[model samples]
Target chain A: MNETIQHLLNHRSIRKFKPHQLDQETIEILVRSAQAASTSSYQQAYAIVGVEEENLKQQLVEVASGQTYVADNSYFFVFCIDYHKHVLAAELASGSVDQTVETTEALIVGAVDAGLAAQNLVVAAESLGYGTVYIGSLRNDAAKVSELLELPSHVVPLFGVAVGIPDQQPGKKPRLPMDAVFHRNTYTDDDTMRQLLSQYEKETSSYYGERTDGRRTEGWVNQMAASMKDPKRTYLRHFLQEKHLSRD
Target chain B: MNETIQHLLNHRSIRKFKPHQLDQETIEILVRSAQAASTSSYQQAYAIVGVEEENLKQQLVEVASGQTYVADNSYFFVFCIDYHKHVLAAELASGSVDQTVETTEALIVGAVDAGLAAQNLVVAAESLGYGTVYIGSLRNDAAKVSELLELPSHVVPLFGVAVGIPDQQPGKKPRLPMDAVFHRNTYTDDDTMRQLLSQYEKETSSYYGERTDGRRTEGWVNQMAASMKDPKRTYLRHFLQEKHLSRD
Candidate 1:
């Protein structure tokens, strides 16, 4: 019932944004709010690259598989899992840095921290009546995005967020019931999953089919199956390795 | 200036929590708020396992290297990157699921979604006058936590959240200046990083030295250097392989 929880619950990805520029002060506040989120042991293993140049934004639009919002939004920030700075910090504090610091766990910490920071930015933006959407398609060609942003070793662009004033209000998307995702002490039994999923399919089917005026008939499961039938972003492992982020 | 952003900016990880259990309705509302967070392509690739049993909490505390907060918190929930349900959904919609669906991108999606969902839960809990802390140390023995939770294939425990009423108010931790984290069109130059980090080290040194009453002389960089000297959680890559989550 409170405004804070209401803002959290009322979130919807905003794709259509008005052609307005965010003031420098507002953008700075958003970044500060992001930094306020909890970091694992305060390593702060993430960085945000805000792109305002029209040329670079256009290139990123192409790199993100033609997400025009990347070019049109008031601000487009690519959030990267950044450990390169920590490596530099270690070297400055100690004589040398350890190679073992590039373990998978370290990589996980960067990615999770990037996520935590980006989500905070989203909530803060929404609270201020600005709209935001995450650009996961940036990973469609992450290397190009990283190259454009001049990312060094131990840093990789994970996703982008486009923020601006809203031009449209999308209907709230329905999520799976709590029984499906919230388990008690342990994972739910298979029988319970089956029942819950069946109900979910029907609910999703209605949402998609009716909302789009029969333009879409597939339910959540079917759409996911189609998407999963083919491989996606298979180059990620090789890319992570190239960036020295996939140490064994 | 708003309550939502104020709640976010005021966040501090609470280790000392009052011994009080959150009511079931409040917990349900928190989980619902978590589900409301944005997901990539509507793929809700996360699940939360609420652990209230004292015995399981004790075991998790041991798994997390005796972080007594895990055992003492009123509620502890293991947040997981879960694609197992998506795999099942794929199977239900189609006759078979593609093994290629378990690519690193898919894993990243799951991990990022888990982070987004968990942050929402934290904010929601905070809105209701609760304190929250993330336990990344759960990954210190992720395999054991998985085994304890009976997690199936393509599912991994990313972290844990300890939530309860606050027993103490810790000073807000200092973060890197916005100049360091929020870059312009591209990442800032090295000279900028060095200058910013020098300032950061001074701030953090004062914070740590003052907080522990001079008992801990190590600044942020020194502590990070010591922790990074040896490999922590080296078994994660192999653990991912065992869970059938390692695909290129």
Candidate 2:
């Protein structure tokens, strides 16, 4: 396999980082790497804000539900789903586009664009000897992150990713069985999901030795169980509607 | 500065592919590379259906708004925003432990997860000497696509990508200036956007060389206008409701 393929096959997320700060040149390389990612129809329906301020990172930490690594990281960024540019771009064509670009489809496009770009940035950072961790909990409170990032209406903060040099390496997180996902021409599996997850649960439960913290023994199934609990997304629809996204 | 960066920078959606078939090992490598992508919470919240049957490919061509190359490509994979597993996982967890998953967040997570993984697959494919094109119009009638794919509720079709050896090489598709999407610490530069896009709009406008298809002159602005004017999105909410995404 080629280097990029090899990198993709061997994947891991590094949450712990060293105190070393990323230089401006390195930041430029990452941003350029991000920009090189494919956008749907070149609409470029996303934007990112480099977080270099200590106070701002603190506020982001609070907004992201106390993921303190966000504040402690050497380099941080917030990726956004933006349609305001198209609204402005369309303004030059005729009038303000009437349709709300906040449909599930639109959100999917923006989120995917951001997601695709963020992955490219991840590999690029790793290539340069930097560590990375994606912050999906940033979506736990959309409005606060938007306000903290000074995001304009019609541009929502999808997620943030903290980047820095490695201080500690997190072991590879276990995944479900390959057959559970990789269907041939159609999606079919005779094996039960419980069986697949059961094997993973056993593997993960003892994978890491016990820590004082409760997260250690929780294992993969327990983690999935925890994720299943409602996060009170009432703020989400309200935020999207207030931001003028949703259906007309 | 590196060959990978150079390859990334030269990305273009290729519609025409040579009739050569990709080996099963290559498909495994590509999917493995895809699985290696960063998934939110490692939920792996997506599914890909590889298309090999000519009859199924023909139906997909129709679902993708009659893109003939979709059926003609060497490898066709449909990416999905799959929350069915989460729902099932939730059902099991809730029955055993009394918990429920957040549907909207799961949907968003699935799309972003699938999109990121698919992008990695694209890069890996290109690196392995293959051409690719994303079929976004698959959302034209999502319900139809779902029915055709035997997709359960909570599994939305995000997009399809066709991959193969290049029968034709295409030039890079233009993109908006970095300033248009990259903000410093926060989003604040309409002026910066206006300046950069003005030049980019010109580049994209001449992209097709001013052909007779009146749309050839629409440029980015015109395309946005035309998209906004799309009445096909007329019953999008009702469609999602029927699909049980019920974002309402």
Candidate 3:
């Protein structure tokens, strides 16, 4: 990995922010650089709402499930996967169009497009000496977010990104062993899975200073449990369906 | 956009492929570069499977609804929105886990994770002088692809990508005006839509070239109409549901 890939590999979510503000020029440059990232089908099926207003930012924090970083950050942006424009395009081309994707796939794609763009934006920002974090919690209540942002019917909040000058230096997070992620022709859940993860967990726990200091670090599994076992897991689909996405 | 972003900006599906073979080294480099992309929380929630064995590639071609590029190309890879490893991790943590996302937000993250990773792979391959096209048609029969790839339940085939040296330079595809995608505080899909797109369609049609042009050409709207009207256009959600996706 050279500098660019190295930068990506060594990325960390920096939540600590100084009270400094990002200038308009810098914001424009970052978004344009983000705009430069690849979009599927040139459908350009995505949008970025730069959160600026104080009350709106507070509402955004609520939309993001009260993640303080979102409201207080110097540079905050919500990346949305959008098909409203495509709907218009569809209508223009062929009167009324059947929405084949429903809201599921459409909303998923919107979030994905935005996430991909945000990833690129983060890398670019980091290259230019900014700290960043991806706020996936922004989707806790998509309908509310849509209302807050006055989003159109075909748009859904994918995630939020916070960027600014670093307030602190947090080390990079450790990844699982390559085999865990990089698999052969199929998926495997072998006993070797846990063994492969053993070294990674140790490395990760050690990096987090949880190895020597007995902390509740169950490693990847624990994190997965915290994340996946929530009742709200499938909530976005309903919200998406509510928004007329049948991603069928 | 410059040449690099221009290549990204004008991306399209090149279904026809010349009988060819990509050397193992280039293939390795491409996949490795893909692996080098930033993974969320360093979880690396995606995988790239090379369809090298001709029989397997043939099956994938059929699986992609007769998109010949899969079997005929120098290369093909299925990008997956995978949470299988994490699911296993959750099981290990709590001694049991659900096969489906308990939350719609988790689904959103997994989907976006794959997209972010795939876009990186695309950019990396393009930088290495490879021509590429995305195979969303693969999603036309995601379940068939899942069975063909012998994919485990939680890992879904979000899309496929085909890459090779270009036999022909596909023309640039225009995007909606920047304002169309970049909403300031909110989104607007109203009267301004028709007025702006009126002339742009002419530009899009011109780019498709004259009717005598050897290549099949359809303007975006017409292309979308064909896609929406195509029987395959509507099967994805059914495939997902039949695959036992529990979007509670």
Candidate 4:
């Protein structure tokens, strides 16, 4: 396999990092690489905020539901789905914000663009031998994160990435088997899903047992059932609405 | 400096592909690399449908608004934000579907996961000297696309990817200046955004003028203004609502 493919296939989320700071040049390269990612209609509907202030990082730790890595990583970046800039740019060209910015499709586009750029940034960091983990829990307290980052309307904090030199190497987590996650021509039916889950349960049960030294025995399904017992981040609907990202 | 970084920085979406088919092994590696992408909370909340049948590809081309590349590529994969499998697995574990499957945050997580996996797949393909482009236009007629693919509820089509051997090399698109998109400590204020837009407008105008042989002259802001005048893909709101993806 080629080096890039090998590097990509070896990806594992790292939550613990050593006390090493990334140089400015490295951060610049990573951000540039992120910008090189394709944007829908060249809208570039995203912006990144790099946080290094000790107090701010500490606050972010709480905002991210006590993910200590938020404060400990060499760098922490919050990727925002930014339509505010596009609004300003459009108004500068014309006299008002484009009507499109108010659509649900625009919201999805912004979020997807942010995801694309963030993944590229993650791969760039990994290629440099730096460890990275995405903090989706950043949404655990989205309003606070936005306030801490001085975000404007039409900009939502989608996720954060903590980048640093690795202090702990997490084992590669198991995914659904290839045939299970990938379908042919059409989506697999319920019968196929049931069969795939039965086999996957066995593999993941063994995987979790090995990783946790038997402290955790719940298979993937059981764990998902427990964690998702209730709806999560339901506030996001109102949050996006307040940001004027929902339907007009 | 590394090959991975260089390859990433050199990305350009290719719409034309040579008449070559990817062997099964290569497709496996690509999907494996995609699965390695970090998902939100191990939700694995995405699925890919590979399409090679001529009739299905032709339908997808129409669904994607006559994007010929959807049919011309060696392999086309539709990436969906899938919670259908999760619902089934959760039901198996707890004897009922979790309430979490119906929230906006859940939808966002699934889309982000799909985007993350798709980007990894693209990078992997690039490393192996292949070209790929994301078909966000897949959302233009998402309901039809889902019906064609037999997608179940809670499994929304996010986008498609057309992968193949490169038949044409498009010039790399320019992005916003680094300081413009990458903020430190907090997001930049309006003044900075205005200044950055001015400079970017000049650069992009020149880019468009050169590429189009001076036939078209809309700068980035003007183009955005024109495109956003009327909301495109307005049907998505109703589609998501019908699919039970939107909040009631």
DockQ of each: 0.76, 0.52, 0.41, 0.79
Candidate 2 DockQ category? medium
Chain A agreement with the truth for model 2, given as TM-score: 0.89
Question: For candidate 4, lDDT tens digit of each residue in A13-51?
Answer: 999999988889999999988998888988899989999
Model 2, range B172-232, lDDT digits (tens) per residue?
6666666777777788667766666677778778875555455566567677667765434
> A4 in model 4: Cα distance from truth in Å?
1.0
Task: Please give the C-alpha DockQ score of model 3.
Answer: 0.41
Model 1 lDDT tens row, B175-211: 9888888888888887778778878888888988898
lDDT of 3 by residue, A35-83 (tens): 7665655556788888888888898887766778887778888888776
Q: After superposition, how far is residue A62 of candidate 4 from its true place, in Å?
A: 0.6
Query: What docking class should model 1 receive?
Result: medium
lDDT of 1 by residue, A1-248 (tens): 68888888888888889989989989988999899999998889999999988999999999878879888888998999987777777877864444654677877888889989998999899999988899999998999998888898888999999999989989987899899899998888777887788788889889998988999878778877777777788889889888887666
Alpha carbon lDDT of each predicted model: 0.86, 0.75, 0.66, 0.88
Candidate 4 achieves a global lDDT of: 0.88
| TM-scores of the models, in the order given | 0.97, 0.91, 0.85, 0.98
Off by over 4 Å in 2: A189-191, A206-219, B94-102, B206-218, B231-234, B246-248
Residue-by-residue lDDT tens digits, candidate 4, B1-248: 89999999999999999998889999999999999999998889899999878999999999888999999987999999888888888878865444687787987888789889999999999999999999999898899889989999888898999999999978987898888789898889998898888888888899999999999777887877777777888888888877777653
Best by TM-score: 4
C-alpha displacement of A125 in model 2, angstroms? 1.9
